[model samples]
Structure formats: structure tokens, C-alpha cells
Target chain A: MLSLLRPGSNPRRELEAAAIALLLSIAIGSLLMLAAGVSPGRVWFAMIERTAGDPYLLGQVLYKATGLALCGLAVALALDAGLFNIGVEGQLSAGVLACAVTGASLPESTPGILAIPLCLAAAAAAGAVVGASIGALRAMRGAHEVITSIMLNAIVAGVSLWIGNEVLFQGGTTRGNTIVEGAQLPLLPMSGSSVNAALVLALVVVAIVWFLRVRTTWGRTWIAVGQEPAAARAVGISVARVQTLVMAGSGALAGLAAANFVMGHKHAFEEGLGRGTGFLGISVALLGRSHPVGVLLAAVLLGLLSSGGLAVGDLVPKELMEMLQGVVVLSVAAAGPWVARRSVTVVPEVAA
Target chain B: MTTARLMRVASLALAACVLLCAGALFYGGSAYALERWITGGVALAVVGVACVVAGAFGSTAMRIAAVIVAAAAIAGAVLETATHSELFVAVASTAFGAQALKIAIPYALAAMGGAVTERAGVIDLALEAKLLFGAFTAAAVGYASGNVYVGVAGGVLAGMAVAALQLGLALRLTADQVIVGVALNLLALGGTRFLLQLIFHEGANSPPSPAFENTVLSNPIFWLAVAAAVLVPLAMLHTRWGLRLRAAGDRPEALVAVGASPSRARFAAGLVGGALAGAGGAQLSLSVGGFSADMSSGRGYIALAMVILSGWRPAWAAIACLGVGGAEALEIQLQVTGSGVPRELAPLLPYVLTLIVIIIAGGKGSAAPRSLGRVS
Candidate 1:
């Protein structure tokens, strides 16, 4: 999507591109709903009414959004470095297992301050190991990160499944043993929903990402390397090191998503835990256009859509929300380039 | 006719007849020891041909080793066919061959389509979307119309429609092909379920409908797949359309030099490729009796992998599909027969093997189109 725009363009134009994409998806989604014999207005109203009207549902949305935001940040950061990290799903899977195992192994009387960070650190470290290995493959061996990441994802899935089936969940049940109680993130005041401190962490990360992108030299270095690798190399920047580091950073952020699931929601590593969030991160990053603020907003909007689909499930299939995300990304991608091209052509006329 | 010319014709006819008879007897069992003889004979011939093909690649030592392995496999298969023909017949029976064909056909078709799409410089990751749309439309239309052929037409058109969307975005709108492709696949999965709910009033599957009597014997789409597997690469090497398509992938500027539009050639490639892929989708539904939502099950992606692994050759992609199908079939057999590898791990063999092969082969003499994934 960044490729569709001018390098280092005004942020407002990028916002406009994202807005146009959203509006287009809304229009298409409404048409689909109408075709399904559902009243679009009522459906949307019900969706908003149930998802955001009730504190419980709103809390659920927030819980979902926390993970999506972290994942969005991961993908957005990688996108900024010109590395498409489709392996976020795999990284998150690794993190979830590691986090669960770490929490389970800690003494039963472990304190929150000690246990939580240790588990989270284990998650991030596991994820970084996966993320950096793929990074090294792309950096040193010149393999396309996309293919290697996908292969890595498949491997992670197989290994995780094997471990989960054999070692973690020894009983007939598919769910793993619970983490120490101290390691769990305290639930928010919302009615019985799993919203917790992870939401705060996600928001903090968003702000951090914003500050890094706008104010940090390292951030600029990655963007520079992304845009012009040879030029960066001419300036004595190590492109390989930067990419590998950025990818590892991306993987760690994705790993942070496990806190929301393991520490807040499930408190255990379950098979099929948080499935599809990694791919949804791609959608968020694309829809967000790789911006920190944009990613945060996109994550909330998508989380609302996911929860809202269930809210309005009786009127239309919840699957429509999934389709809507696809429509959103495709419209965004298609419109990005066309709008940019038009803007380019219009600039001369403006000068005249 | 001249005596020599007639003799040559007679010899050719005789060879064809023997091949057909052997293939029939190998799959369709016989009363006598003749079945065993035919099975062994076919096995040896297949292994011999494999050895010759393997000889085309690898160092001299590797080639020699592969040949020795091929010889051992051939001798083992023949001996097994003679005494315990159960193993050979299990793999080569009419039922098993049909199942493998069913498994391979859709993948082969999609892979061939992927070969054309990627070879023409468009990275087609949404082969799934096209195939899914094809399958759903074929099932829906075929059930509604009670006419299988018309349903197949609907599927083919559906595939082309999806192709046009991809091309419009990737080529005209200059969107990122991989992103568009991925988004389209997600949309296809969800959209098909949405449509299924709307049309069939169910999300899981559609009602069963009339289908082809025999895919191998009578299905037009099956023959089309066969033709695509055999003819696409030959056309790539020979035809004007083929040359222009290659140029579109390798050097779009060369087409401009010749006063031709590479975009046009690419569009042409998309049309042909989309239709074949769509037909595969139709075959999937029609052969299976109905469409299950998103039933292609990553076959389209695997087909794309095979396309890349085969270095963009349609024939090799089809062969790769066969290999994948064979592994899957063997995995099923292993579940029943039991094995050292966990039954759970058996299914991972094809995917893991493909990944390993790709890693080994990716760096050396990469044959991907020069301007691949670049929207010009």
C-alpha cells in the first residue's frame, strides 16, 4: 500500500486514501447485505447497538482490539521497513506456548511483578527467535521473506500442534494447564469481559511507535533502508542488520499479543487460540496504511466489526464481517494507487 | 501406400494399442497372471521414464545414484506386483487412481493457470478465490439448472470474473498483486459462505446435484485439464501468443519495441488461465456431487508453490500435484496400516518436503520471470 503512494508524502493524503477505502468498503458491504435480503440500516444499527451499547460487548471488543493493535503495530512496523511479516501468526503461536509454559513453571506463590514480566519476556523471546531467523534468511541468504515466513509458519504450526498434543495437554482435553494466578492480567471493570492491562500496553505501544517513527533516528534509518537500500548502504548503514533487527522487533510486538490472550482472556494455551488474528493484522496494517495512530484506529474498527457481526448475527451471517475486511483491504489497495496517480497529475495543474 | 510407410504407421498403431491395453489392465484388473504381468510391466516403464527424467538434472554422480535408486524401485515394484500385488494394486487400482485423479486434477488445473499468470508477470496468490468462486458458482448453478454443463459454464465465467478483478487492480489500478490476491482469497472464503447462506440457506454445503458420469471418460473439463498440462508448455515454447506472453513477463519493453502491448498479452494470458482454473473448480463440484464452502483447502496455494518449484512449467506443476496427491493418499493408507511416524505427522510430509526442496533450489539459477511482481 505504501508503494501506491509517493515516498514520504503528506500524512493527510495517506489518511484521505484510507478514508476513501473505508467508504468504498462500507458501500460494497451494504450492497452485499441488501442482496442477502437484510436491511442494511437495521443491521448496522443493531451491530452498533449491541457491540458498543453494552459494556460487556464493548469490553469484549476492547479485548479483541488489544491483540489486533499489537499485531497491527507488528505488521505496520515491518511494513515501514519494507518487510511483509505474514509470519505474525506463527510468532504469536510460539509466544502463546512459551508464555503459558513459563507461567506454569513458575512457583505457585510467584508475585505478579516477577511472574508476569518473566512470562511476557519468554513470549517475546520465543517470537523474536522465530522472527529473527526468517530475517536472517532474507538478509543473509537473500530468500524472499514472504516465502520463508510462510514456510516458518507451517513449521511452527506443526511443532506447536505436536507439543500441544503430546506434552502440554497430556489429558484428553485440548486445553493446557492454567498459568499462575499472579501472572494473569487483572480484568477491567467492564462486565465479566476479558479486557485488561494489555489494552493499556497496546495503547502505550501505539504511542511509542508514533514517537519512534516521528522522533527516533533508528526509525528513520529503517524507513530510509526500506526506500533505498543501496543508498542506505552507501551511507554506511547495514541494510541486513537493520532489516533483521526490524523483523525481530516486529516479531516481538506480535509476541506481545499473547499477553492479551494468555494473561487476560484464556490464561492457558488452547489449540486454535486466537486463530486468524495474524492475518487480520495484515488487514489492519493495510487499512491503517502502516501508521501508528492509523493502526490503532483500524484495530478498533475491525474489532468492532468482528464483535458487531455477532451482535447482528440474526439479521445477517457473521461471516459478512470477514468478507467486509477483505473488501476494505482490496478497495484500499486498488484506490491507493489510482488516487496517488491522480494527485500526481493534479500537482502540475495546481502549480499552473 | 508404400510398404515402408505402411509398416511405420502399423508400428505406431501397435505401440498405441499396447499402451492403452496395458494402462487398462493395470488399473482395471484381469482374471489371469496377466494382470500381474501388466502391473509389473507398467511399473517398470514408469520407473524407467522417471530415471530418464531425473538424469536431466544433477551431477554425474547424483545422476548415477538416482538411476540406481530408480532401478531398485523398479525391481522391487515388479517383484511385489508378481508375488504380493496388493501393494501395487492398492496404489494403481481404478478406485485409487480415480481418487488421485480427483485430488490432482483441480490442483493441476489451478497450477497450470498459476504458471501462466505468474509467467506473464502477475503474481496470482488468489488462485484460491478463483477456484472457490468457480466451485461455488458451479455447484449453485448446476443445482439450480439441473444441467451440469451449464453449471460448468457458470463456473468458468465466475473464475474469469475474479481474474478480471485481480487484473484490474494489479495491472490497471497498479495495486500490490500479493496484497490484492490475499485479500481476494479471504473475501472469496467469506463471500462464498455469505452467498451460500443467502442462496442455499446453509453455510456448510449446497444440495447435491447431477454430475458427470465419469470424469476420466466423459468430462470435457478433465480433457481440458489434460490438454492444458500437455499443450501449455509446448505452446510456451512455440506459439506467437507464447512468445508475446514470455516477453510480457521477461521484458514488457520488448513488446513495445515490436509495437505490441504487453498488457494485452497479459490480459490474454489471464483469460485463458482463468478459464482453465474455473473449469477445475467446476470439475471439483461436479465430480464430488456438490460444493462445500472453501473446499479447495489450500490446493490453489500448493499449486502456486508447485508452479514456482517447477520453474513456471505447467507440465511439472501437474506432476507435482500428482506427487502431492500420492502422498496424501499414502498418508490415508498409513493411518490404516500404521507407521513409525506419528499418524498426525504424516500429512505434513508433502508441505514440509516442498518447503525443503524450494529452499535447496531457490538460490541456484532462479528461473522466475525477471520482472515478476512489478506493476508497470
Candidate 2:
């Protein structure tokens, strides 16, 4: 799952690949819908109508999108530097763990300005610690990030579950203590919708990432290291430092997803909170072509599919919706490159 | 420069951890310390001692003896810690070995399956997917038909189906192999859950099925794993097809020079690998006599890790899986013995051990196939 598409030769080629992939996924998805004896048109229509009809439901999609955008940016950030850090799952969880504990443990009288920033910082720091370890392993031991990521995922899952079960767990239930009232993010003006200021945070992050990638020397340095590490080194850039920073930066972005799950919505640490968001983020990043604007749009698109899956549960098996999503990812990963190859001149294989 | 420094720092950190555990053992002997650090602590200390002895002695036999002694020390330490009395004899009984072997069968098979596809230059990240698919098919088919062998066969086919999707997309369509595998994993996870509800009308699990007895002795799948462990490596080295498959992974150009299709070799290996993994999945559900959502858990990933640790050799991977299984069995034993370790943290044992072992033993650049994870 980690080594899918090495970044394509150019941004234009990647865009073409993603478009082609989307078309293929739709084509295959329709076939699957037909085979399953479900009406594709009805399913799509119902998914769209049900989700868009209710303000609460629409807000729920935006809430989900808030997390997805952060996570997608996390993955996309690492991809920018030519590294695959699949440990976003662990990083995100680490953030949630820390953020939840910090929020819940804070003094009840603390102001939102104080408590919120403290919790957010806790989340980011925890996630960055995990990410930095992966980076350090690569820099110091030449350990593959994928291998370390797998190990860390296991460790974090166990550690988080242990802490949840032992320390934070409330009696007779799975979840832990709720956050202090001051730490809670305010709900947006939408009537009775769970959407909160975190949506704004997500967008602000997208813009920040855009600015970083576009305007900063740090941005260009990482991309240089990613595209050609040896050449970047010859020009006095420390590839190791850039890679490590990229992983840490990626980790922090993933950690920031806790803003939606912990502060904005759940208000507590729950087991399996933001469970599959990290992996889903990969889909978003790919579909969005690793661009900030593209990721924001992709996150919203996925949020629709996710929320819509439940809306259409009566008409079709909700699991099929997930399968279709996976199909889209696979199709894009496969046919996107294939279509791009068809259009462009063949590049000679780089020597291993 | 970095590798040496890493080794020094790692070993030193491990050595410090051992010293801390020993100090805690004598002073307070907290259960928390024992649960998390003792096994790793003793294991690393033993390895360091063995390394020093071997280096000073400077003979192959001496080195072997040092390693043997270290192994014995680790086993003794664990046994002593697990059961502090004559209870040790009971824990070491035949039943314990049986339990460990039964647990190992699926992991071993899955890891070996990982070897087949990975050695052929295809990532088997979907091994987890195959495990779930295989288990679901085996249980559902076994329940519906009341035929154990048929259910196992069905599981194998399910595995092959996942493998086909992965290989076809990655090899034929020129999709990114990793992405295709990841997609398949997601599909397997969700599709199985959806199908469970659709077919069984229950989300929790399938109905009890006609399954083999829980013992590994009665399980045909166990023997298959054993056979693969013994034969797969030999086949990979000795057979013409195996040679071609290896060429596909390590040097596809060599296969091109010989005019044998690399993708065909990969496809064949993938199918066989899928079957072995599928059988492992069958054993999982059949032994339980039902299918549960996400029942394969993370065994597939553990198997994937085992592949890397074993240097992508099928038999070695299978052997490494036994250690993991043993860790699991030891945990169960400790819990039964009323050991004071936190029950919630018990699940961390095998993973923690794997991580420690990987850091100490793995991360070698030489072990991987030169052309692994490449498109021809």
C-alpha cells in the first residue's frame, strides 16, 4: 500500500492520470452496481439528495471533510519530499490521544484561548514525536519508513488502547472523560449542525500549505530533495534534514486532524476515534493530485461518499459504497499512469 | 558512518533499558516494568553478551555456542517470569506447544505467502485482505455446504481472487503496485463486512460452520503450511520456474534476455502464494467455526513484517512466525496463571517483540532483492 505511484514526471501528467482514473472507477463502479442488482442511478441520486437535504447532514459531511483535508495534506506533504509516510494512522491517533487527555485534564476554568491552544499543541507535539522517530530511523539507521511505520502503528494502537482502558476510561463504557467546556470548539451558525470552527481551521491549513509550497524556500528545498536527492546534496542541501523535517511536518498535519474529532465534535477520547481517516486521506491526496485546493475538494467529495453511504444503506449494502471508493482508488492508481503513458513520450527507466 | 552509529546507539539504549529493568526488579519489581520491559530487556542483554563472547573467542563454534547459550537464557528467563514455581512444568506441557503451533499455522502460511509475491517483485500488502477474504469464504462456505474441505478450497479461491486483482492491476494495467494492494485491502475489509450482512443477515458473524477440530494435527491446512515451509524455498532456488520468478524480482532484464515473461512468472507465484495465505485464512475461520468482521485482525501485517525479517525467504519467514505465535501463547499462559501484568496491555507483547527484534536484527540493505518494488 505504501509504494503506489511514484510521483509522475510532471504536474500536467499527474492531472491527466487522476482524471483518467476517475473515469475508469466510475465505469467499473457502474458495472459493479449492475452486477449487485442495484440501480446505479437511484443509489447516486439518493446519496446526493439525502446528504444535501438536511443541514445537519450537510454539516456532518463538512465535519468529516475537516479531518480529511488535514490528513490529505499530511500525506501530500510527505509525497512532496518523495517519502511515503504511511504512519499517518498512528500519528493521527497519537494526536487524538494527547489532545483528548490534555483537553479533559485541563482546569475547568481555563479560557478557550489558553485550553484550546494547549490541547492543539499537545496533539501536534505527540504526533511530531512519532513522526520524528520514523525520520530519525531513516536518517540514522537507514530503516525504511514503511517498516518503522508498521511497527509504530502497532505500538501506538496498543499504547492508546491501554491508556484508554486503564486511565481515561469511564465506568461501564469505552470512552474517556470529556473535555473541559472551555476547550470545546464552537459550532458553526448552521442550525443544529455539528459543523464547527474546525472547518475554518482546515481551510486555513490548506491555505497555509499552499503558501508554504508556493512562497517559501523551505518548500522548494524539500521538492528539490524529493525529485533528485543526489543533485540536491551536491548543491549543499542536507537531504536527511529535509526528509526528517518533512516527516515531522507531515506528522503535525496529521495530528491537527484531532481538531475535528476531539475538540470540535467528540469532545472526548473515544476508542477507534478517527479510525480510518488516515488511510482515507491517501485516497483524498491521490484524487486531489496532491494539490491543496484539489485536496480540499477531494475531501468534501469523499465526505459526501462517506455520509451518503449511510444515507443509502436501505437501498444498497453500505459496504458496497466503501468497495466502490476502493475501486476508485485502485482504478486511478492503475489507469491514471497507463493513460498518462499513452499520451506522453516514454521516459527511460532510471537505474535501480 | 550512520549505520554504525545507529547500531551503537541502539545497542546502548537497549543495554540501558536492561539495566533499568534489573534495577526495578530488585528494588520495587513493579508489574508495569515486568510487563513492558523484561522480555526485551533480557533478550537484548543476552544478545549483547553473546556478541561480546563471540568477538572475543573468535571461532565459529564458539559463536554458535554463545548464541545457543543466549537462546537458553532468554527461554529460561521468560519461563521463570511467566510462572514462578512448579507451574513452569505445566506451562511447558504438550498442550502449550500445541497452542503455539496452532496459532503459528496461519501466521507462518501468511508470511510464506508474503515471500512468494514479494520475492517476485510484487508487494503483498493485500495479504491482510486475502486473509480476511479467505477466512470469510471458508466459514461461509463451510457453514452453507457442511463440507470442511470444500470450505478450505473456497477460501483458497478467495485468496487467489484478491491476488488476481492485485497482480492484474499492478502488472497488466501498470498501476502503482502499492496503491493497488492498498485498494484491495480496503475492498476486502469493507466488502467482507457488507457481504456478512447481506448473506448472513447478521453483522456480528456468520453461523457456526462444519469445521475441522481445533487441533493443528487434524487440520490439513497445517500440513500445507509445513509443506510450503520445506518446499517453497527449494523450489525458488532449484526449479526453472522459480529461477525465472526470481529473475523477475531481482533482474527482469535477464528474463527479457531469456524471452520468458516476468509478469507471467509473477502471476504464477502470486497465485501459489495466494493459495497458501488463503489456506491460512481458512484455518482461522474453520478453527473458530465462524467468520467475524475484521477477524483476520492484523495477522496479515505481522506476516508482512515476518517477510522482511526473514529476508524474504519463505521457510525462514515461517520459522519467525513461530516466535510470534509463541509470544501470543506465552501471554495467554501468563494470563491464565494469574500473572499481575495489566490485561489491557497484553496484546502489545507480540508487536513489541517484533519491533525490538526488527531493530536489532533487520534493516539490512543487502537482504532485499535489488529490483524489488520496481516496474519492468
Candidate 3:
């Protein structure tokens, strides 16, 4: 158990570190709930019960998890290439718009099989374009992708406002027209819940990503580039090309995540459809350690927390859950290094 | 020294003027029919291009001439606009300037904070968190104490605490600064929103706190912000402590060679930087009279851009803040005036401009701290 807690290159230590960080975050979260005059125990218990007991809430959690997992994968992909694409939020916005526009433009007679796929493809392409712009800026102009991505988020926000207001806005409303029936993803057989094919799609994407990450030549090169760009360049790998392509792929994942909303849940584009999903993806990726399995699990856990937070609104502010998410990410980052250092020293002492 | 380089710049300027003149001519038929000011602006822009071309020959006279012509072109545009609309002049001078100053304050403070921390080789992306937490603390304290000053102090301390978290996580534990910063920001947002709702039973905004009246001289926070902008640069450039911090950023091994601790210097710099950012946050909440959810509203990010634009110079960063503030002020003015430009597009000006500036100026030879964002 102690060896598990020791931070090392081994996956077991990483998992232990993550678990410890999560526990600490929960402790901090409980204290915060108590300060707010809510019984942390009651709130947490209710949160779990509501999410686990109710089929509808469970569906909602899965719905949220679908989008978050894809976004986590998106960020993880970029990180794999040594690129920080914080513009996942912006890319999601672009995808939403793309799906909305494509959905709106397509004929109502078009079959759902064709239309839904087209919308998803459009969204992914649009997001890839946006992500590629940031990558190109980083590669060609030497602009730091971090700051550029942040700026792009703001710009995308403005652009979305314009699109919602001027282009796609329904009469006298802040929302766009609902997509054609054929464009909507079919709901699953789950009773009274909006769980759709998107969840299955998310899992499929996760599997494909895991395969690509662990098996492909490009994947190996991407990992090599991330670890040591100069060494990769010395070995004749075009780092710039890898950065651009990985970032684009990352953006495509985020765009696909938008399908969980625009296609699965909302059936239309709205002003805040993918609100906070992009940033939440960052937290999910951190918590999951960017592994496909880890990201899937982290996404589901966060989705549960969000559902739970909303459920306990009468006792504790739902925002507390978000704070806990943030705390988990921070504590995990902090704890991993602390445990790693300790393990290093302890190992040296043992050898002596 | 190379004619080819000079010619390239000259040709670019010439192309720019030609495009501007053509645009003016094409659009001149409606509002600018026979408007000599439009013609004059175009003419002066042409003259500026000519002077730029001449200046490539390495003559100071030609360079000064180019600057004068460029200034005249700007004056011409202003003259045309001012002549066309009296409200534009009035708004541009008083309301716009005042609004710009208010917007600039927090940006300048945050940028100064960034400058200091970055100079000590730490990238504190948690300025957004610091500002948010500080604003919340100030609002809560100010509401409770009914004294804006005490509230401000509370805000500063809160900011310091947040900064200490960054220092510990990023420096002590050697975590990714960006991740830590992002986490801090999310935490601040969530924590403040939770607390606000819990305490006030409202999720949107804090109850109105003691606020400074709009009296220019009487508002202590405004003056304090200004003092910080001035003093921070002086402290950064002049003090022995400042020198150590600089070395820690650029040459930590050298500082260690001299028996000084780079980590301590960095820690101290982070604290001071956080304090300044906190002061800025105080200005934001105190001026508005309360904390609003997500009130920092990406200003911290803009301040980061301003730091890059200013090339790590504190004073210049403050000045850049004013320029960004002007863009924000213009965004508000466009909304109010119902300008011909799309309202949605108007709010995008500052962000788009930041991207442009960063793209153009962020390349090789830019003055980022040598070891900025490096792990010690």
C-alpha cells in the first residue's frame, strides 16, 4: 500500500496519487460545505443516492460524461504532442456552430443516419480548422499556444454571440431553431431519459483513441516529440507537423464532444450549450492522467459530481462541487510531485 | 543597412496607404462626400509611406518626417470624426477616457503582478483566481465592516493567500504552473460562487458594499492603484532584492554561486506580485461596489497579453493596459451609440487586437524573461 502511494513511473503509483488527491479534495469540499451550514455528510449521501438511485439522473450523468470524456481525450491528445490546447472551449464553440449550421441547412427528408453523421463530421472539421490555426500560429509565428488559445476562446465567444444573434437566432429568442428531426441523434431505450447514441459513440471514440495512442507510428512519434522535441527533430521527425496534426485531432475530439449537446441533448444550438464543458475537460484530463480508461472514468466521476451538486442545491450550493473538482486537480498535481520526491529520497536511503 | 529590407517595409507601408485611400474613396460617397479631412488623411498617409521609404536610407530627418506624417494622418482621421459628430468628441474625451481609466486599473495591476512573477522565472496564470478571490474577500469584508479600506486589506490578504498556494504548488512541488494556475482559477470561481450564494442566498452578485464615490481625488483605491503602477516598476528595477529576483529568473545558478537563494527570491517576488494583483482586485470590487460572479471576466487574461505586449516591462505593461482599456471603452461606446459596426463584432476588438499584436510581436527577439516559466 505504501509502495502504491509512492510516486513513480509505474501506473499503480499514479493511481494511488490520484486517489489520495481525490480524498484530500473531498475533505476540503466537506469543510467548505460545513462552513456553508450544510451537513457535508447529508449532502454527499444525497448526491450519491440521487445519482445512483434515479434512472433519469443516471442518464443525465452519462450524458454529461459523454461530452466530458471526448473533451478530456481532446486535451489529452494535445498534451501527448507537448501542446497545451486550452482552446478546446473555442473549438467546442466552433463545433456547435458547425453542427447547428449544418443541421439547419440539411433537408428534412434526409435520413437520420446520413444527416447525423454529416453534422458530426462538420463539427469535427470546423473544430479541426480552429485548432489548426492555433497550431500554425505556434509553429509558424512562434506565438505561445496557451495565450493564443485563451484569446481564441474570447473571440469565439464573441463570434458565437454574433452567430446566435444575427445568423441562427430564432425570432425573438436567444436560441437557434431546432435542427431537422433527421439531424437529432436517436435517444436510447433508457426510460424517461435523454440518453442517446452519443454515449456509445463516445465509448467507440475512446476505444479508437486508445488504439491509436498505443499502437500507431504517428502515436509513437507524437509521444517522442512531446518528450524531447529536439531529440525527435534530431531523429528527423517534423515536430511542427506533429504539433499541428495532433492539435487538430485534439480539436476534432472536442468538436465531436459537442455532438453530445447539439445533437443528443439540445437538438439545437444555443448561446451557452457547451458552457464550461471545455474547461471541465481540462480537469477531467488531469484527474484521469490522460489515459483513455482513466479519462473515461474521470469523466463519469465528474459527471456524477455535477449531477450531485445540482441535486443538493437546497442544502449546499452546487458551485461547491466545481470547487472540489478544481481542488482535486490542483491537489493531484501537487501530490504527484511531492510523492515522487519522497519516493526518490526513500529509495536512495534504502539502497544506502 | 540593407536597401532590400527598407524597400520591403516601404512597399508594405505603401500598400497599406493605397488600400486605406481606396477604401476611403469607395466609402466616401455617402458620409464623406467632398470631405477634405478624409482626403487629407489619405494624403497624409501617403506622405507617411513616402517618408518611410526615404527613412530606409538611414536619415534621422526622414524618420522624424515619417512620424510627423503618421501623426498628421491620425489627426486627420480624428478631425474628420470630430467634425462629423459632436457627441463622438464629447464621449471620446470625457466618458470614454474615464471608462478607460477604470478598465485600465485592474489590467495594469495584474500585468504588474505578472511582470514581477515572470521576472522571477514563475508564470503565475492564477492572476484571474487572485483577482476573483480578492474581489470576493473585499466585497464580503466591506459589506461587513462598512469600511472600504478594511475590505481592501482583506482582499489583498486573500490574494496573497491564493498566491502562496501557487508558490507552494508550482515552486515547492514543481507542478506545471499552467495547470496549477488553471486549477486555482476554477477553484476561485467555484469557491466564490459557492460562498456568495451560501452567505447572501444569491448566486449572481454580492450585496452592495461600501464603495468609493466617483470623486476622482477622494477615491483612495484609484490613487493607490496608480501608486502601485509607478512604485512597482521602481522597486523592480532599483532594489537589490529586485536584482536578485531578476537573476533568479535569468541566471539562477549565478545567484546560487554567489551564496544567495534563488528560490527565496522567487518566493518573495511571487508574494509581492500577488499583493499588487490583490490591490488591483480591490480596485475592481471597490469601484463597482460589490463582487459579481465571474466579474474578473477575462481581464486577467487580457493583462497577460498586455504583459507580453509590453515585453516584460512594468511601466510599459501599465501603458499597454490603458490601450487595451481604450478598446474596452470603445466596445462599451459602440454598444451605447448603436454604431454602424456590428455590436457583436465591437466587443471582439480587444481580443482580436491582442491576437494580432501577439502574432506580429511575439516572435524571435521579443523581450520575454530568459527563463520565464522554467522549472528551477
> Which DockQ values do the candidates obtain, in the order shown?
0.23, 0.52, 0.39
Model 2: runs farther than 4 Å from truth? Answer: A1-12, A233-236, A346-352, B11-44, B47-78, B85-87
Model no. 3, DockQ: 0.39
- 2 against 3, candidate with superior TM-score: 2
lDDT, residue B290, candidate 2: 89
Task: Candidate 2: give the clashing pairs.
Answer: none
Better of 2 and 3 by lDDT: 2
Model 3: colliding residue pairs: none
Top-lDDT structure, candidate number: 2
Top model by DockQ, which number?
2
> Residue by residue across A1-352, what tens digits does model 2's lDDT show?
2333444346777677677777777677667667667888888888888887888889888988999999998988887887767788999999999999999999889999899999999998888888877876666555557667767877788789878987888996889999999889999977687789889889998999989887899888987877778899999998878888989999999999998999998999999999888878888887887778878988998888888788888887777777766776777677666766688688886643
TM-scores for candidates 1 onward, in order: 0.84, 0.91, 0.88
lDDT of 1 at B320: 69
